[model samples]
Every structure is written in C-alpha cells, then in structure tokens.
Target: MVLYAPLLFLLVLVGVQFALWALAQLGVQYAANHALQTTRVSGGTAAAGRADAAAVLDQVAGQVVVDPRVSVTRNPDTATVAVAGRVPAVVPFLRLQVTTEVSAPTERFRALTLSLTSPSPAGEGDPR
Candidate 1:
C-alpha cells in the first residue's frame, strides 16, 4: 500500500508537468499567429511583425520560454512570421524547444490597366 501511494504521487506530478508544457505550446502558437496576421496586412512590414511577436511572447510565454527569438520575412505577395524559444521542462536534464511559423497573403488590390489605340491604315488593307 505504501509503494502504491508513492507511485500515484509520481503519476500525478507527471500529469501536472505535461499540462504546463501543453499550455506553453498553445501560448507560443497564439503569439506566432497573431504576429503573422498583423504582418500580413496591407502596408505592414517585417519590422512590425517582429515587434508584435516580441510583445506577444512577453505577454504570453515569457515565464515558460527562455531566450525567445522572432523572425519575419517578406515577399512580393506574402509575408512570414516565425517564433522560437526554449521552454522549461519537467526533467532538469532535458531541454525543450518550441518553434512555430505562419504565413499569409498581403491584403492589397492589384491595379487594373486599360489601353486604347487608334486604327491604322495597314490593318484596314490587310485582310490576311
């Protein structure tokens, strides 16, 4: 009976540790997605994305992660946001890392062009 009690206590501790890790994962993902959404908007720049990611990490995952990193990339048609960091783990010997990326299209409209040309005598004479 004493042995069973110890084992049950260990199991409960493991469960609690796992739950904390899961919550940290969710926090990182939410931060990454929010940063991406902000950067993908029209006139938004990569600098803005990085700033937003940092802010979110501080607000959400600061306690769980150490040495957080944020990266932002831009293309003609799309923008990308990446967030990465290390999270505290249950075991002291093991180090945990988390990374997430999100991308979205820029919210802008392409300008339409219209062209008009006068009829030429060469076109009227050529039936072929």
Candidate 2:
C-alpha cells in the first residue's frame, strides 16, 4: 500500500491539472467566439472585439490561464478573434499552452435599385 500512495497522489494531481486546463481552454474558446460575433456587427471595430474577448477571458478563466492575450482581425467582410495563453503547468518546470481562433462574417445592410428603359426606340428593322 505504501508504494501505491505516491502513484495515487501523482494521478490525482495530474487529473486536477488537466481538468483546470480543459476548463480554461473552453472558456478561452467561448470568449474568442463571442468576440468574433461582436465584431461581426455592422459597425463593430477590431479594438472593440479585442476588448470584449479580453474581458471574457479575464472573467471566466481567472488563474487557470497565465499570460493570456487576445487578438482581433477585421477585413471588409469578416472578423476574427484569437485567444492564447499558457495553462498552468501540472508538472514542475513544464509549461503547456493553448491557442484558439474563431471567425465570422460581418453584418451590413445593402440597397437594391431597379430601373427599366424602353427598348431601343428605333430598332433598325422596325417600321416607324
């Protein structure tokens, strides 16, 4: 039984660390997706999207993530959000990280116009 105690403790430590990492990853992914959606709005800006992502990461991830960073990119028609950070190491002197990105199309309104023109008044063969 004495020999098994250390192994059991190690297993529990690894399990708890993995669980925390998984939760942090999920939270970061969710934040990225949320930021992408926010940036997809007609008038949203990349800075705004980045702020939103950062806010969510801080709120949900807490200490699970270390050195977290948020990035946002925008094009004429699309927006993307990326979240990156290291998950606190389970083993001494080891570090593991996760990065996730989410993208969405921007929303906008467009105008439609229609015009009708009389067929060429004088077709070459038309009898006047």
Candidate 3:
C-alpha cells in the first residue's frame, strides 16, 4: 500500500497536467471561432471587417485565463478571413503556447464596394 501511494499521486499529477494542456487548446479554438464569426458578420469591407474581428478577439481574450494576443487578417478581394491567437499553458513551472488559426468565407454582394450600414446595438439581437 505504501509503494502504491506514490504511484497514484504521480498519476494524478500527470492527469492534471494533461487537463491543463487540453484547456489551453480549447481556449485557442474558442478564440479562433470567435474571430471567424466576427469576420463573417463584418462583411468584405477592409476596415469594418478588421474592427469586427478585433472585437471578437477581444471578447475571447477577456474570457480566457491565458495571455491574450490576437491577430486578424482579411482579404476583401478573395473574400477570406483569417484569425490567429496564442493561449498560454495553465500549469505551474511550465511554459507552453498553443496557437490556432481559423479562416472563414467573406460575405457575398453584387456591388464591389460594401455599403456602410450602422451596426445594431450590442446584445439587442442577432447581427445576421
């Protein structure tokens, strides 16, 4: 029984470490998904799309316990949006960074230039 105690403790410790790593990955995925959603709603406009993506990233950063650093890039011509973010590990005495990227299709419109429309008030309703 005495010999088994140390082994059990070690297994528990390793399991906790793995859980932290999984959490970090989940955080990265969350940030990526948020950014992609923002880009889709913002449309193909350069400035507005970037701003929307940034806002989404900010929201995720606020909720995540890890370091918050997000980058958003949009190609209006190609109608593609890319979002990237890094999540820090939660375990003590360990330094791990998990980066994730997500790409989304841009909005479709007949006109080359997107029309400037006022954004609806936050939490009012669905933007779509």
Question: Which residue pairs overlap in candidate 2's backbone?
Answer: none
Name the lDDT value of residue 121 in candidate 3.
Answer: 91
lDDT of each: 0.82, 0.87, 0.58
Ranking by TM-score: 2, 1, 3
Q: What lDDT does candidate 3 reach at residue 69?
A: 54
Number of the predicted model whose lDDT against the real structure is largest: 2
* Cα shift from native, residue 50, model 2 (Å): 0.8
Return the top candidate by TM-score. Answer: 2
Q: Indicate the TM-score of model 3.
A: 0.55
- In candidate 1, stretches whose alpha carbon ends up further than 4 angstroms from where it belongs are 112-128
What is the C-alpha lDDT profile of model 2 across 21-101, one tens digit per residue?
898899899889988988889999999998898888888888888999998999988888889999998867667787898
lDDT of candidate 1 at residue 94, scale 0 to 100: 59
Models ranked on lDDT: 2, 1, 3
TM-score for each model: 0.76, 0.83, 0.55
